[model samples]
Target: MSNPPVCRRCGEPVVASAEQYEVFERMHYVCFHYEFEHQGDPDVECPAGGCPAAGITLPSLLFRTEGLDLAQAGNTVVPAILALEKLGFAVEHHDDGFAATARGSRFVAEDPVALLGLIKLVETRRPWRATDAEIDDALGRYDL
Candidate 1:
């Protein structure tokens, strides 16, 4: 028998028909939905000219010199913590608020273009996950 397709995002076997697999880009429906369709914090829109979330970065949210408490983090920041955590960029510290991990700090310091590429991909391709080549291509296409 042929091997079942694996989801590109979560690395799980996809239980879908050939056409469904093609439609979902080999990801589970739920995984595809979350990565490509979930518009977090419906009430909050990114004020930045073209950002998907409010104009906040992992560094700005987690590595602030002054640090942040829950009230200071506010609605926009709180909603994004889980998504950033999923991306391995931040961790929540219960009532202490969120902090960036080593990997996340490196991402902020070393790869300024990564976030722009991610936003461009979500805006155009809606992939559950992107390969490096795909990110580069998206950035080029969008001139970001």
Candidate 2:
């Protein structure tokens, strides 16, 4: 008579046939696994040869500029700049060089290694696993 329960982690419906988990309450199996094993920790290393936080890391963003030498070749920077803009991250082209906006700088302040782990979680298409609130908390921890 009751509707099927929604997964607290990802806001999706929890079907009976699929695997499930309980961590204080019901959640998708994969969501629970990722949270239990990897959430809230920043010491985790990035996967080898991959970008940190889905290539959102400061160095990785900088790499885009460096790889193309955006300053010397201004037009080529458009794509990378557009990508960041689309993602809601702030970027600006200046007389001196390209730089992340304040919000962007704040994002990069988080440890790159930890971000790599978070990025890996997001790349799996499990959006609930790596939320903006969670990311802000992770980035804030560096101050302590």
Candidate 3:
């Protein structure tokens, strides 16, 4: 048999059906999102429909959690950290602050829609009080 189609952007096998290959222009979803949709400053919220940074005031929160100093991050830091932990994107380390979970880092790097969903949940709900079931439901809406 012939080889599978390759991603134009990353030069890897597309690993999709013929229809999906055509639809995605022979690129992985992540590569397409990065090459076409994710542009300009990474810290700036992406305007693409499912981008986590969309309309958020603190997009940098997604990337710079480790060793974060509450004193430097200001009052919202606590809420943001709480929200991230509630979403399973971050884990608290007591006196050391928070670190991104493996899943969270993968989402930040590859899945804009999932990232958007997490941010939306934190923005709309009180993460400090949100139940695990509620968080699961919110993420489910994004098919994560």
Candidate 4:
């Protein structure tokens, strides 16, 4: 068997440019990407041309796609936030909105799940924001 050879969204010719591409089953599309697992290069941009998914690093993709953002920190926060946003959680800052960091923003765009998650987590654990450990524990309790 061989890979299907075009952009499912635009019907454009797909190139073997990135290390891999993702299959957006909901959208019935296969998008090219530069993820770490199947990634070939870090410097190359995704071939989709202005695709939001292209902005996410491979780790982010895996994090969100796998639903693993319950408890995290550092670089994980960004991806976890992105994952939540992708899931329709409605993100916004405490005062602003669900925009990823400048670099993350470029990719995460208007995802709100992260913000929603943050708010919910804050409310549930008031007087104590979550640490990676707490999050992991909570996620585990829920079987994530």
Winner by TM-score: 3
Which pairs of residues have clashing backbones in candidate 3?
Answer: 52-116
Question: Which residue pairs overlap in candidate 1's backbone?
Answer: none
Write candidate 1's Cα lDDT for 1-144 as tens digits: 887898899988886544598787778776666567656653343333333343245443333334545432245454455555555664434353334454434222222233323433454553658789989999989977
How far is 132's C-alpha from truth in model 4 (Å)? 26
Q: For model 1, give the 10-residue run with minimal summed lDDT.
A: 106-115
Best by lDDT: 3
Q: How high is the CA lDDT of each candidate model?
A: 0.53, 0.49, 0.59, 0.47
In the range 57-81, model 3's lDDT, one tens digit per residue, is: 5545444454765443355555655
Q: Which portions of model 4 show Cα errors greater than 4 Å?
A: 1-71, 95-144
Off by over 4 Å in 2: 1-5, 8-75, 102-144
Kindly list the per-residue Cα lDDT of model 4 for residues 9-111, writing each as its tens digit.
5566555532333444212233333322224454434444443445345553454457544544455656766665565554445444444333233223333
The C-alpha stretches of model 3 lying farther than 4 A from their native spots are 16-19, 42-45, 52-144
> What is the lDDT for 98 in model 1?
35
> Distance from true position, residue 22, model 4, in Å?
20
Task: Please give the clash total of every predicted structure, in order.
Answer: 0, 0, 1, 10
> What TM-score does candidate 1 get on C-alpha atoms?
0.27
RMSD of 2: 14.3
Question: Looking at candidate 4, what is the lDDT of residue 105?
Answer: 31
